[model samples]
Target: MSRKKEVAGSPQRAVRGPAFGYIRVSTQSQGQTGISLEAQRGAIETFSQAMGYDLIEVLDDVASGMGPESFCSRRGLRSALEAANSNNAVVIVLAWDRLTRYSKFENQLRKIAFDPNRVVCIEEVELRQNGSKAAIHKYNEVMGQRISSGTKAALDRLRSNGVVLGNPSMKTSVQPLGAQAYSRKSTDLVRQIADMLMESDDPFSVPSSTVVIKLKERGIRTMQSKEWTASRLREPLKKARRLIEEREAPEPPPTFGMF
Candidate 1:
């Protein structure tokens, strides 16, 4: 196999170093859709090739960009940062948000791991070291403030409009203002599961494995069209049991001695 050689007289070829690529998507759906992992990898590869950098490795994650905890918990990000720091290599990302949504976290990462001269984002941003530092700093400040205020405003609007924003099980949307949309099949499955749990001596304490076995016997598959694992059935079963208990709980008697 013939190894590709760098073309002569290319500016990028003249400026070369080891480059570590990092990519991320907030959800599985995002990983499957446009700007997917594959797309990000391609972009990174192209940039690395053009810059004549030895592409060390591409690290990735399917995680939210909400906060520092989210970024810290990502195994790939940790490994990538460690590798880049140890190798004294540049870290490349497709965009700024791919690195972090939080500006504070981004700044901290730059101070600790990312060298402004080495870290490169494919997107045309003012933060590039080659750009005017003073101008970029002012621009970044204004843009960061705007983005933060905008996000806060959006969240406030959602809260005011009664939209559930977090975990699916914990989410409850009001009608008229918001819709509590559940598929018919899912509703029926949950109800059946609830009934099965209610038959146990203590529904809340019932093992998820037992529920999974029952579900399997019934030939019922999850919304994802897969056999239920213990973890998969846990939350739905718990919610079902809660609903059943609420329905079965007795009402208090009306007081008749009021003067």
Candidate 2:
């Protein structure tokens, strides 16, 4: 790792493949909470070798990831993007959060004409394979429905009227993508509730409100760790329906009829 390829004074170079490596540590010392700097490098190095990404340089950053972050704030990120632009290499991070805590990470990627598709998050890719990203993506879809309006509303209404909006039938199976800093509680609960409803003698008649009550009676909570509500159940409920359709799973044993 010490073999320097010298990307304008970058000290670390792992391989000579087409990919670039970037790692970050929010804590001042490597001993702080979460993955140490070396661990990230090791992962990125191994990934690059296996994937044939000639990782020339691995930029590092150590700073508090608070509030909105910009390329100007993190010199390492800025350098990585610049190098990516010049080398036409994709940037690699151990995880998306390590790249930047900011919600609008695309802003930085957009600046250097970097192909957003090329910015690979190793863990996220694995999660997609595991079907674990399903619930998180469902949450994001719900958020979009809440925030996007006007023309978006028009498009949605049109689609509801039987207008085609892309391929509505296309889908990828997603499982819960949870790691040390994440949790699969939300996904697991959603699937469980879905199974319960499906196993019911008459699932269509089982009011979601009543279901919420049953959940509270059982001391179950939402992904936010709050009491579940009928409205709160909407998105995940739809997701459950999709799973039932996609999986065509046999009716599981009665799991929630005891209530």
Candidate 3:
């Protein structure tokens, strides 16, 4: 047989199967920072070609590493799961955490009802197979739960010490504003509004519409990559107290409210 024919005839040769790739960017900044959907697709395609697998599909979503508590909230992720389950193609991801942060993702996995044995997680290598899937998921669930609980406890302790939480650390990377930086801008605007409010004659006294208009004039914007409205303005304004005040202050008179 010819060398090509002989190589093709070898049963011991590696053969990649049909595969599906999934990518997610939690922040708009990630989308523009070049780890975008297209970039992910290209990487997955390269990986698939190198391994000789046929690239069948790509699934992605924009969601945070917070938790899968938002599993239902993400249409793209839901569709990705459905595609993976329905098709026998290998479901590939850049990382497991891209699926969700540890805590609630295991619960979501369990609820998904796919055959545990048929599942495989591949990073630089295949991490697990279907038979080990359930056990691995359980382990992840336990770890995530423990971490989440520990985080809550830590935050509570910090609160008791009067330390601020969720406020960004100065060491973190600064994100830009607008469609490319939704959460960052929204957070900044809320903080600014909060400062204005808590220092006002009455924090709750300002109309939401008025606050939004004021915010726009000052170049404030929403996290959803859009302008704020009266009702929408009310939400972030309400959240301002939570973000600005780590814990509730003792009730002073509703007026004279510099607690």
Candidate 4:
């Protein structure tokens, strides 16, 4: 709003040196039921001010986040990434879904040499990561965990509103398929890790190959979209063991000094 350089219709930005806003919405604009581009733009611009972003320009796309569409299909999002790379600026969004709800966007960002720190989400609770490869992977792990929670939360909300998920009255025609679809969710991955830790007497000395086999058996892949590796499992294994150790640690005796 700070006197942006406007064209006849659009604005010509690139002055303040670091920020691009990307917004995506479905076709339901003009006071529709769900969301409006105006609202998204306003929220982003306001957040930009507080975050000290120059807010070079705001590019928009009309699309639904629930689709399995690729990022290349989104011209506006692609353009925003290109522009961000050109200016070495940050790409800010109102929420993670405004960018994408899945981990696929990670490859797209890396392909264009975009820094992970530059991708900002106004409503994100996770901290941003640096441009290091390890940091990006760490960020992806955090996002992978957070992303899966939203779907279940939405379904719960629907149930609370008296909305039925599956047909309640219909009888099943076939037997239930057991573990037909493997879960790649972060929580599931953690549970697998915990199981491995419990089976090992020396949890700290447990090899990465053992954990990788467990993951493969469960059909879970790392955020990098491949079988788990030592480097990828390093942090999680240590963290999980530390957590277990903390949980099973005995409480210390009361101090000699009186309260």
Candidate that scores best on lDDT: 1
Order the candidates by TM-score, highest first — what do you get?
A: 2, 1, 4, 3
For model 3, the stretches where C-alpha displacement exceeds 4 angstroms are 1-15, 32-34, 115-122, 126-259
Per-residue lDDT of candidate 1, residues 1-259 (tens digit): 0122333554545557776888888898876553456556666666666556777788888888887677677777777787888998887787778877876776667656565556677665444333233323443555466568779999999999999787665435344223324456677778889888878888888888888998899898887889999888877887798788888898766865563
Arrange candidates, best lDDT first. Answer: 1, 2, 4, 3
Residue range 1-259, candidate 2, lDDT tens digits: 2223332443454544476778787767652532456566666665565554677888877865555654568778778878888887888787778777777767656766777887878777563432224323433444344456446878989988988886443443232222422446656877788787777876657788878887788887877788888898888777766766666657757885776
Alpha-carbon lDDT of model 3: 0.61
Name the 10 consecutive residues with the lowest summed lDDT in model 2.
172-181
Residue 230 displacement (Å), model 2:
47
The clash numbers for all candidates, in the given order, read 0, 8, 3, 0
Off by over 4 Å in 1: 1-15, 32-35, 110-117, 125-259
- Cα shift from native, residue 188, model 1 (Å): 65
1 versus 3: better lDDT goes to: 1
Model-by-model lDDT, in order? Answer: 0.71, 0.67, 0.61, 0.66
Q: Candidate 3's residue-wise lDDT over 1-259, tens digit each?
A: 0000111232342556665666778877766543355544555554544455555677677767675467777666666667667776566665567666657565676688744333334453543343134333443555466568778999899999999776474335543333447666767777788887776676767777778777788776776667879877767778886765653466567668575
What are the per-residue Cα lDDT tens digits for candidate 4 across 1-259?
2124232433344344578888787564532422345556666665555444677788877766554475767788888889888887888787777788666667657877877677887765344222122323443454455456667899999999999888654445322322232333554566568777788787767778888787788787875568888889887777677777876899877984566
Candidate 3: the clashing residue pairs are 116-130, 117-130, 117-131
Candidate 2: global Cα-lDDT? 0.67
